[model samples]
Target: MKPMRSIILVVLLTLGLFMLSSCTRTDAPSESHSIAPSQSTDNTNDTPSATARISFVSAGNEAGFYSVEEYDGHGIVAYIDYATQTQLPLCGRPECRHSDSSCTAYALVENMSIPVLAVINDKLVIMQTEVGSDTLPHISIADLDGSNPQLLCELDSNISISPQLYTDGANLYALATVYSGSGSHLELYRFSLKDGSYESLCSFADGVNGMITSCFDMSLTLMFTRIDEESGSVEDYAQVFHVDTNTLDDPVISLTGVSEEAYTIYNSTLITLDTKDALTATMTFTDLRTGSSVEYKTNALLSASGMNSATLNVFDLWDGWYRITLNGDGKFASFNVNPVTGEFFPMTLYYEDSMNVVLIFAESGNNLLVRAGWDETRDGTTLTNLKPIYALISKDDYLHSVPNYTYIEGLDL
Candidate 1:
């Protein structure tokens, strides 16, 4: 009986090999448009796995001419396209303003074949997917000449659709959720374009199971954290972890200090600042080779008079610098912190009244994109009177304006 089963297995394997060989063809698409036979090569070394460039686009709204209404509710995707500037719409429409409740409700167009937009060799490529579906996820690949988008691949099952997309040169990564027994589980997956394959790099379970609030991918390593809610306390804890994809079996190496609320990791440094209370903490480099931790702390309250406010706002952190907005007695002020030296300095950026402001930090090539905005501004002259406007900070210290009244388009791929 065992011999018979082995023979049957061998027969099945032979038939499968035959079918796979017959399906293989040499007419696959190439980077060029010529009708040449596809050359067989190892796809593993096809593209470098690093961020060649970074791009930004706004959520689809009416003001932008080339705006895409697909990203109405979801966060905007940054694609790099140098041929022509594309516009993305903002969240609310004039008539449907009150109807939209959350940013997640916007209809999004998914393309998995070719990247919607990409930066290859410093050239921006814009390609759209030929296969259209509201249910299935696909991508389209093309160059910057508005060429026809080539179908790359289609994901059919057990996949969480991500509206937030980013790429590290060769492969693209996105935040997706998988179906567990009780609820969904959040995870990050790496998708390869050359082989049309994907693998889960990280995951977090439900409940106090360390949910990912944000991530930053630099070089071959990924620096991210899990935001876990305390069992009884209102405060949350952020556990930072660094993963190197090169070692798939053992990626995670070091962990950082836990925080009560928001934190940012950059250049191997961790910054945690609490808004409601005047408290800030910083962690030095956590050497993976040796388990060692270095930490620094400071009182959130800067001035003796400003300590009375119950609520504050921490904005941006890059390299070792931090930006924070403080509000008290109906007044506001912005301060910068040097995490290395624990020095705090005031900045001219501030908002008046009590409007909420959001800061978006993005890196484009050697440039750093910083966008700041408030609900309303008080006349717009004094730091106290002016509302937050999006500011673009370049590597050369050049600042550009992300106009509230204009449209911006592009992708990171």
Candidate 2:
């Protein structure tokens, strides 16, 4: 199957939008620099904090099973079998790597390999694909140990599935793309994990790049960007509306000229990536309830780590900073972009060959957690099997060598 993020086509937004055509000129190479870790000016001197439990998926010996291992910077602290849907009895031994090929956690799932998308409420939300079939992309929820797998819903193979999925206590949410003769549209769906059912929450003709649903005026409101599919576009704007009502009649806020795909609403402020050209997108911030907005520019916003493809907003905010990962181009690097200053801070840990390194979770001012795969491949492009790996980078040593790692030999499927 195709890489999931490419189908969304958010970051690869072309060079003809008004944001691109109106640019003063292309940026010179001097403005772009490979930021090394030791050069970070942001408090990289603080003492490294104690290691804590962080969640990651481990490849199992069985065809369809992956172990959800909780590592404490040293060894497995806790683990759940991803395929059997059963939690392995806590291995009585400490410092147990749990790498034994015969470990009880290994189980089979009819020879079908799935990628764990989200671990919610002790269950695994996985991306399901069929062998030799490229069109049957769907999501399934299985017990944390990988048992009782249930198909939640089938997805449009044409639309890309956002790797960043969300859950609010009871429902699972996702953003996807839909293309037809009329053009492309951004759509949202909510699956009721409890009932194995889902609903078409909404769609945006302006094309959605990123989205967040939060309580506004005591009700849930969805906030996102409305971007034009092409240059000379008229639909580019920042918008939000109540989830219970039709957005067609909702009043449009005053925010303007924003790419819908590169934004997030944080603490009542709408942060968006605004660019007239592909090379110099400005990270714009606007107050949703007020009529004020702020903008910051950076070259890093245009491309990401691996294939130098495009940037995908991971929807994480750290102490007034936003996190984004480079997707598409098979490049691997994460950036902590300040929405207020338009400055980009590239993480030090680099992934050779693959753009699979992502900042999955983080603890501000302490440690940044990342989920990645480590294999013999220096570049991730041609490897059919990758060994899953996880690491913790120190805040003081974001560019320092990875001080800790947990590696499991398995196919990265």
Candidate 3:
């Protein structure tokens, strides 16, 4: 856990470590997955816990969810109490303090092994390994609360499960990365838990790098970017790849098609910016959930409005937002785009001749996770680097242009 600090992002971002497979459950989308990111509606009454308050609170599922607690260079996992909303170690041993490796909660962390916390469907599935425990990482079966654990199956590689996982009922989509001189991509090893024997299928994805949202059944919405082999420049904007997650049935890989450096698949719609004409552009998005054909009328609308180009940047937020950069006098002017209503929101980072530029990390519930960075300068010399802090704010507050931020203390990792 100390040297293997690279996986801290995966551990903390669980929001809660339950990647529920899209099984025969009739739950809403909110209750179907685990994730984290957000900003300043931080409750002032939040009593300080010994562990870090997970930036993204996972309140979707009520059966209790798992997350990480990285304290004093030591990484440990904990489960949030459903009633009291307090963080507690996974160890259930009577009279046993959880400070040492003897506790089940700290054993894996103390051994310095990579542990992936996930609950595939209704059962708790923890892929972990201890120093003297086993040679290879094994998937274990345990109760929903992770009691009386038994071996499930040994993973061929070391246990390094990504916080984000996708599944379709019987299969657990594990994460992997493709490396080359060109770039890396987000890869998935679809391991089956119940479709007969132990088998895996690599979900096909074509991109230099990618981030998957969820495996809504057999489909995944990926925000990826491809490197330009000719120009050698990474594309200016992100591209969306919505493809079949399981290629077991059909050997042929089915790609919905890549957009012009900019695309987004949100809600049930998959939209790509059509930039064939330099004078104007059009965006026609199809609802993959319904599989309906979308016609072209947005291009005509852009042409009628006399716009310059179709190149845009899509921000994969809670819903969807885009930004269009226009050539300004000295700096590039970026404006946020509203796809549905075709409205634009200018992004001016300064007011009253002062500035406080902020970075948005994630959106959780009605809150946003943002960090404001600024430097103090006096007597012609810069005083410090970017002094910033993680905070939470209501999405409604941000939408209404309120700048009040509730700074959280322990979100720096």
Using lDDT as the measure, the top candidate is 3
Candidate 1 per-residue C-alpha lDDT over 71-143 given as tens digits, one digit per residue, 9 for 90 to 100:
3233332221111223222222323321233321122223223224333322222223223344355544433
The lDDT of each candidate is 0.35, 0.40, 0.42
Ranking by TM-score: 3, 1, 2
Candidate 3 lDDT, tens digit per residue, 1-413?
10011111121223311122110111111222321211212222222223322122121233344544554355555554333323445556545455686765555345445655555445555655322254554566554444556666665443334445543435445555544466444455555454323443444354545445333433554444445567654432222222242332321112233333234444345555555332354556566556664533334333333454433333333444443333322333444555666655555533334332244544445665554443333555745323234456676555445677765433122
Kindly give the number of clashing pairs for every candidate: 25, 27, 11
Worst 10 residues of 2 by lDDT: 14-23
Reference-based lDDT, residue 163, model 1: 41
Give the distance in Å from residue 402's predicted Cα in candidate 3 to where it truly belongs: 4.0
Residue 199 lDDT in model 2? 67
Better of 2 and 3 by lDDT: 3
Q: Which ten contiguous residues of candidate 1 have the minimum total lDDT?
A: 14-23
lDDT of 2: 0.40
Candidate 2 local lDDT, 332-367, one digit each (tens): 456766666666667555566444433333222364
